[model samples]
Target: MKAVILAAGYGTRLLKDLQGADEQHLQDLTGTPKPLLPIAGFPLISYWIEALRGGQDPIDIFIITNELYQGKFKDWAKNYPFVTVISDGTSTNEERLGAVSCLQLIIEAFSIDDSLMVIGGDTLFYEDFHLQDVVEEFEVLYRGNNQANLVLSYTCKDDETKKYGIVETDESSRIRAIKEKPSPPETASRQACPCFYLFSRHTLPCVKEFLNEKKDAPIDEKDAPGHFLSWLVTRRPVFSTSIAGRFDVGNLESYRLCNKYFQENIRKLNYLQ
Candidate 1:
């Protein structure tokens, strides 16, 4: 399967904390756009590439970035044979396409039709978890006549429901409702949407439909992926799978936590060597 990484955002929220770090340090320090930032002495994206390498399928990676970071991403990905980087030019959040739009761009550009895995560039996860397994299961469900997309849900231990897209699922693991940080009393469970998603070819039409309908409306928020998935679940049979571990590098506290986790667990990751 192929993976498309959404990395075009400026990550302005993380700049202050990451100012003095080197490339790799910048990545681990803030979970920002610097994919080359160091995590345990290797580039941040390197870990993801290595994890995909361990998958059963031949994983092809495409990183979407803005013009300013394209050259850096190319340089960072040079040693990885299965990775490619594309620049979306210098566009603001409003001017540029969001995660879903970037996925569509990659699909059209590469002519990809098979199942695709979409991940946020800044997310960190356990190396032992085989992302391909998720993709394979998603393919199975799709072939079994399941007509919706797959969302990787992570159980959050905190009361920070306001920080994420919350999910409510039925006993069969089918998504019953998804809210982008709904009021606390309305939340069904702590299961929240991480940045990972598996989509079949069937999802493209839904995306196109969403885009067509959204073209006339004004965007008030920046959660593009959440908006897309919300639209998909409303029209199709969306299912949820739990991620073993998930870390968000965007927030200051989570960024620090991820760095600490990596430091303590570095030896577990063979990719560094």
Candidate 2:
């Protein structure tokens, strides 16, 4: 199996907090360019690689980050044998490509056609949850002639649901619809979509078409994956599996919360010496 991680964002919100901190500690303090943030003495992306490798099948990992951090990531991850880092180039002025577009670029660059896993660089999840199980489940669903897309869902009852892409699933565990941060009382269930997704080769063509169409369109499309996913679930089959716990380390509060959670649970993640 192959995994693609999206790490190109500038993380403007995180840098806001890091500006006042000392230059040396700034990176550790805010965890911006999230994949490079320390999780236990190692970069956050290291933990992700560990989790994916800890799964039943060995995976080839590909990371997509902006050009500036490419060297740093390469230096930090040199010891890891399976990782391959790809740079998106350094130019924030350019209207950046959305998550799916980045994935398409990686696929086209590498000529990949088998099942692929896509994840956000800044997200973390339970230590016990094996990414292999999720990948295996995707294979089962796809082999059953289900469809090309499978989204990992997490059941969050707390107030955090407002910050995520919420999902509505059918009785058989297939995703029916998804809404991004809908009004609180207007929701049907608390299951939300995390950053992890599995897709078959068939989705690539649709993604290319979507990107091309958006390029010619005048309006900017926010939440590209969600929009593409909503269409996918309606026209074809899509499956969802509930993950127990996960964290989005994109902001100050969540970054602190994730650090605390890791400290309390995963003792091995001592990032600061």
**RMSD, each candidate, Å?**
3.2, 3.4
Taking all chains together, each candidate's TM-score versus the true structure is 0.87, 0.87
lDDT of 2 by residue, 200-270 (tens): 76765666777676775532362346666765677667788887878877666676688777878775432
lDDT of each: 0.73, 0.73
lDDT of 1 at 146: 51
lDDT, candidate 2, equals 0.73
Q: What's the residue-level lDDT of 187 in candidate 2?
A: 84
- lDDT by residue (68-140, candidate 1, tens digit) is 6777788777787678899876656556666666777788788887667788888878655556667677887
